[model samples]
Target: MRKSKLMVFIISVVVMSLLMVWDMPKVFDNINLGLDLQGGFEIVYEVSPLDGKSEIPEMSAVSKSISKRIDVLGVNEPSIMIEGENRIRVQLAGVQDQDQARRILSSTANMSFRDVNDNLLMDATVIKEGGATLAFQNGIPVVSLKIADQDKFYEVTKELATRGEGKNLIVTWLDFEEGVDSYAKEMEKVAKGEEPAYVSAASVREGINGDAVISGNFTDESARELADLINSGSLPVKMNELYSNVVSAELGEGAYEKTMIAGIIGYIAVVIFMIAMYRLPGVISAFMLFIYLWAVLKVYNLMGGVFTLPGIAALVMGAGMTVDANVITFERIKDELYKGRSVKKAFEEGSQMAFSSIFDSQFTTLIAALVMYWLGTGSVKGFATMLMITIVGTLLITVQVVKFLLGLLVSSGWLDNKKTWFGVSAKHLPDVAKGEERKYFGKFHNVDFMAIFKKVSLLPVAILVIAVAMGVFNSVSGNGFLNLGIDFASGTKITVQSDAPLTVDAIEDKFEEFGYQVSRVQLSGDNNEMASVSIKEVIETEDMYELKEALEAEYGYEPSDSVVTPVVGRELVRNALMACAVAWVAMLAYISFRFKFDYAISCIITLMHDVLLILAIYAIFRIEVESTLVAVVLSIIGYSINSSIVTFDRVREILDGKENAKNPKEYYKTVVNEALRNTGERSLITTITTALPLIALIFLGSPSITGFNTSMLVGILAGAFSSLFLAAPIWYTFRVNKKPTQKKQKNVKKLDEPTEINVPGINS
Candidate 1:
């Protein structure tokens, strides 16, 4: 502990902070943004098996083919994903010509050639893929096509040339359907417009092969257009629209700006609270907090991770976690200082004590993050990936780097007797025997949490039962398990644009008059100039335009609609359920390995309770359950585990350290109660710190994100409650008080009384 090391640590932190700010703009510019954050459209298309074909086209090949076609739109950084077996999801960001993009994407573009007698000849198969090139033929703009098989083309041309009875011609059709093949008829359904799909029919005086030119009064621009279309090739399989969404640039830009402001405000609020609560140590944490954000973003950029709205929220929330880690260490040090220990000695002991708690909390959350990455999709997947990366950054930055800096200051001996620096007032110090003194934040040390739980346990249990009943009734009533949002039910969502204010009632009335059952109506925009109307029943493409026009004519509102087919909706529901189950099991298994089966089961039960409570609230309130609900549920799992891990960590640490141990039945309650009390401050502060960022999201984020934030807020509260009152008490009951019938079912011998076993993580 020397002054030289302290100076070095201070210099390193300052320089890193300065460099981070200096390079932040460059990192921001390089960062990738998801369609939701960057204003674009995403579509999930199901590639149905072509007529007469028993099997569907290869999904990977289909994705690649679609990717090549999408590249023609010239949208930067388009993403193409193959989902399951027959679906391909395409996302194009910052695309303005949505109509053109849609048309080009779904078009069959199945080109063919025929003779004057309407006799079938060679089609695109005879032409090499991507072989079309613009050319000048006879001083006119023309499209050149290279033959894939010279012999087949020569034979066709020879046949045309021999038909010299004033009939020596070949015809070209962009979307040719002779109606012979049923698959061709299917293509007929997808290819039709005001502009003819035909390019030209030319007379052949002599037989030719290899390469030929087609000119049909096409200008230079039209020639290039034809060349590009031909080069992009044709769809290998018919793409059925499963789901599609279009977001305006204005909406995305506004969300980005507002979310940024909210994050900054939340960050400042947390920093101020930290400083006020812990004084100098809080200042040290704030400096490291700056570096935490900077380092996470820098790594995120390097990893080519896309930043979405939820992803941004994860970063802000991660800052809170970083602060929580710092606080845990700082609080322990303050406790030591109150016991009359020197600042240097306190730092040494406190840091070691805090390590186990920090490790358990971070790793449990990391399990959730990893599960999400493996199971989640689209922007949800992005959020999971970002969370995983941030967890690592938090551990390295706060757990390691912050510790190093704080230790350097302690080593320098500059903080020898500065008890006040850690928020320990002279009056707060205990007068007990030296080293035996203890200080508590509040005088609830003897409050029997278990006794209170015995009384209030009925609240959560009753609410849960009611929630399950409501879900059953709702499902049986045909609405769904919950009032599923359009995201979960495949249907059309029409985005109506108007400057005039409108009521949801009036909109619903209009839709009802049109024989449409309105599921829900959402208003957005700065002045509520947009109404997104959801229709549960699937509507035909032909009727979509008619409906849009009718609504516009009646209300002077221009409506653009996006559709999600029931197929994608079903898949989403399945995956969401699986993700929740897998995440919970993963956390349980991890805890079992780290601690014991008793703690694992208890933690899992608490986590499940928190999610059930969230679901119950959503159902009772008739809130829309969608993909974001999945995010909220999984996040609660993480938070719930985090709290339990911290508490259990302390429990294990204390029990292991006890040299004079008694029978488990004799001291179980005393030990368990002590563990919970020790970690009570950390659990409470961590929730508050993390919840602050989520509160910002609820108030300042985009309207689209309101449901997500509400779920998150509820989750934080539920996690805090369950971890404090439910987890340990429940575990104690499981370990110490199993009835005879329960023992028979569990296949364990009945015990005279529950006693602590010498398990690996249990006082081993």
Candidate 2:
């Protein structure tokens, strides 16, 4: 049986290795890249009906029309999604001319016919859906339209024909805005030697017409585009850009490279830490972490998910989560080994005992990830997506695959007596045959966590109070509670890169040259060659074009820009609050179900503490509060509960054994302290592993994600502190202070008789 188990383990390793090597490259190749990663733009437009009385156009039709219009630009893999009742989101990746792309996309291809008097006769309603075709009339390219109504066209032609000489003309106009554009105005511009606004004007020889030919001095490319726009059904609704994020290719490539390097470095550090700390089990988890990543990437690619900067951050966080699970299990096994149990017996009992803690932690985090996905937009949603994938992947790989591999190794009988292989030292092991008491061999085994809980808990509370006071002060002083970024506040942000170092004054002077003053400017990059400029007022579309051109000419590269309207900013703020609230409620309910209400309340308080602490830091430090901060808070809410749950799981196990203790109050405190001492090392190790990659990101990753990494790093430390010192103590207080019912007293008295209780966990 030992030989067979060994052979099965070897075969499984070989199979997994083969699969990973074969599919890794293909998985990366298949995954989609978001605009932030690949360089392009994403815009959400609020659509309104063209005519006031008309109902909003079907979103599907609008999306389809936009898709067809995108094809005219020859873009690859454009994403057009209809959001809500009247908003359409268009994401175009790898488009060079953002200004032109935006213009083409939102252009109302409302073709119209007018008499010489410039009075409208017929609109685009007369044209068929797919009837417009490119043609040549006497060597000049033209757009031929198959009229849907022959009679209306004939009547328009007849009116034009009745007007004599040059006045007997049918004027064709494209994108004629009501109360703004007219054929007479366009002809007046032509007379003044400026370009005509109308597309063409042709003499109407007769009133007989089934089709219409629009002839302007059109180039082949221009004619084809005009025909394509007409053929692609006109947008029945007007589109107004509410939010847009545009990135330059140079910026995208730089961000992707820097973030990837940071991620690889972080992953390497985590793997090394795991192997060194957990010994042989660490090696198994190390190997499994590789499999975990490959599996997550494979699943994400299959789901057609786009990889973003935040998504990469989530992947790193997921690695931390997986490490936490492995550490928890390994710690349990070591505890069992400390009791002088055989390796196989220890592994069996430890795996079973660690199941509840792992499940509760991962599930609570899963709840937060789901809420973020539902309410977050843009990169926040991407972060949530990758987080969800990682959670599911970590749970499956760590719980099932890691256990199975470890099981095979244990069952092979090769590791039967070597407790040290699982990081247990011989000196720490008790002599079970001699009836010695089981001991904790962890580093914090001597520290009474409850003794110092009051002092340490005061720290977070004071910080929270300071944060609130700062918020109130800021509000009174007219500075907002937190510094809001473009994602949560309406503004224009432009990021420009130059070959030469840039200064705030230089950039301000440049903006002044364009007749505008920037609200604020900050320089980054190793040589200060990049500048982020913000404007309180959203720049008009025409002004943005001129600014983009002037900046590109000066910097030798086009600057990336983001414009957010007040409407989108308000919506984003609401959604972020909603995401956080829903995450809290969901985690509270789940923790309550898995444990008890007191445990749930304590965990929730700890989570809120971590979130508020981070917010307070942000408020005091004046960090830009943006959508990414939402991802950070929710992630902390999900993850901070882990240590609390692990400790509480231990408390429950210890309490079950002392259910009928003589002094229930003193025993409750004792159990919590014991649980803390027992689980303290694993919790610290989990945070360290998690922090390793986040630290790398903070120092080495793109400047764009620096805020995200820093916030997460702060939350991680706060979470570990609160879970260790605050949550357990809070739970202890709740349990000891509550009065027990009469039935419980009787039960305690009944079980008071000296008898053994064999609890079904490791310590039991």
Taking all chains together, each candidate's TM-score versus the true structure is 0.87, 0.90
lDDT of 1 by residue, 623-730 (tens): 877666666766677667877887888767767845323355446677677777777777777787888777887798777667777788898899999988899888
- Give the range where candidate 2 is weakest over 10 consecutive residues by summed lDDT: 743-752
Model 2: pairs clashing at backbone N, Cα or C within 3 Å: none
**Reference-based lDDT, each prediction:** 0.77, 0.82
Which lDDT tens digits does candidate 2 get at residues 492-604?
Answer: 87989999988889999999888776766765666778777887678898998999999999899878777776676667657767887888788888878877888988988
Span of 10 residues, lowest total lDDT, candidate 1: 181-190
Against the true structure, whose TM-score is highest?
2
Q: Model 2: number of clashes?
A: 0
Which residue pairs in candidate 1 have backbone atoms (N, alpha carbon, C) closer than 3 angstroms, thus clashing? 1-411, 2-411, 2-412
